[model samples]
Target: MTATAPDQDIALAGILRAQHGVISWRQARRRLTGSAVNHRVVSGRWQRVHLGVYLAYPGQVTRIQRWWIASLAVGNGRPALLAGLTALRLHGLRLPEAAEPVHLLLPAHRTDRDPPPGVVVHRTRRLSRADARLDMSPPCTTAARSMVDAAQWAFDDTTAVSIVAATFQQRLVVLDQVRTVLGTSRRLRRRPVIESAVADAGGGSESAYEIEFLRLCRLAGLPRPSRQSVRRDRSGRRRYRDVYFDPWRVQVEIDGSQHMETRGWYADMRSGNEIAISGVRLLRFPGWAVRHRPGEVIADVRAALEAAGWHGPSLSAGSGSATASHDGRVPHRTRPILPG
Candidate 1:
């Protein structure tokens, strides 16, 4: 039987009205009954988000859903973070159509008698000061830690690279921060490769692959090229390139998985035609070479530049992996163009 309004349960009405008539049954039960309050929940008046979680308002896009989950998880002795894809959404990294399953992380010692419903909880062993980060809300692992974690379990390399590049471009973390986090966790395997690339990839850098490719080129002693160089052609519009060797009139274009999309392909074709006819030697490098085999990438780049009438020493005194190993920071030193 429905627990109809009792003779003098005005407290329930007061609390409900106080919450703008949008309190949940769980909250109502806590205040009304000494042990457990009983009531029938209305369908339109109260929509069930999860099994026991309800939203009282008719059609409110409530931010309270996440908080409600957090409160419940915290009660279980594990202050959970609305992490992974969920955190990415909150940080405005993922677009609307790209939304995925919400990922949560909690300590292994959650004391709840039963696990929280509607959440996939990963029990992490520890969260360090570096790892612990604050973004849109509660403390979660910093973007660098999250990126390293994601890079390991990503369904695809493209996804991992995208997230990592974004974290760096957004200024959430840097190469050194990632390195330190990796050193502390010892969980991420490819820290050396990714951290090394972060230095070259700065703001406006398209992808992690692009960053690493540029880094390898720099270390290989190629003249540091201008990033995203824009020049107007006869059409009187802007044409951008990944890297531009101005004196050599060569433009290197790094294409990743995303560029394989229909629109990207179309744009690439158009830009390629335009730049090609403009007398710019267009060199394209696939993402795999940039991420995995940088030595090979450097070799190909040197070849392309040389073919583009660039006559320079194949091996420079400063050209080697040992150059970046000295100190992993983006060099602000003036890049002098060699005599062509």
Candidate 2:
């Protein structure tokens, strides 16, 4: 039996609500006459976002609305779930470059070319039901699958690793989930690099800076330091150190850009004072210094470790014993520092 007009109105409203006010021409044609759809667009009540996708509102499209438009525009009678960095953002994994050019995943059989501008479509044979969260509005890949996709599609190795690390740090997904996804995605790009990053993240390297610091230690031949080690401050509050040489009583803090903020700066100063009062030698380096000035970071860390009773091999700057590669990578070192 044909549905009544009120029922069609209710269905259309529900779709617009769930899709963030975006709809496809194919969907609109089912609920209303072609003249009705065209009248809304002509009267400025709706805007065409793509060839067949329309926004119910006339104002600027939000980021999330853009996601909906991307999915609906390219769906083309098939699944088109958001994946890669775009899905990672929806999973609450914040990053500097997590905006624009919505990434989408389509079935391997999809041969449709010419996706709308500012949309990237990736075809995969392994987009199983387990990999996608169909229940979500503007459906996206699962967090673990999204992380894998984001890492696989990242512009560079560092970015790939950073995405994985941030996912773990944000508690968006578990190590086992990521490993399970990787286990099934056998032919993924940068698989080894993603695995190494996952290992580091699982070992408690909560940020990319900490991961880089661990690499520097291995490059300089320094004894591995525990990462994100927990200890009580003077007032008996639990404090986590970025890197700690437990035996030598030396601690190194890697300050990210957030440390420049007033509150973060004060909090860090307090943490430093606590470390000093606890009789641990404290050394601090900004995130940039770790990436751009690894040699200096290595020299200072080596000196502090030596002074605190580490008799490791000298990695002095003058002797040229240990140095980072020109590309700012530590060669032949992929071991992760376990937490204490």
Task: Give the candidate number with the greatest TM-score.
Answer: 2
- For model 2, where is the 10-residue window of minimal lDDT? 331-340
Q: In candidate 1, what are the lDDT values of residues 133-243, reduced to their tens digit?
A: 543354455666676776655666456656677776666666666666656765554544444444445434666777666656655668878877779978798767778
Per-residue alpha-carbon lDDT of model 2 for 202-297, expressed as tens digits?
Answer: 788989888878777866889988989899876788889899999999999999899999999998998888889879999999998987888778
Computed on alpha carbons, the lDDT of every model, listed in order, comes to 0.59, 0.84
TM-score of 2: 0.88
How big is the positional error of residue 206 in model 2, measured in Å on the Cα after superposition?
A: 2.0
Query: Residue 28 of candidate 1: its Cα lDDT?
Result: 58
The residue ranges of model 1 lying beyond 4 angstroms of the native Cα positions read 1-30, 34-37, 40-71, 74-79, 95-101, 107-113, 116-118, 122-149, 152-158, 168-189, 215-224, 232-238, 256-270, 285-300, 309-340
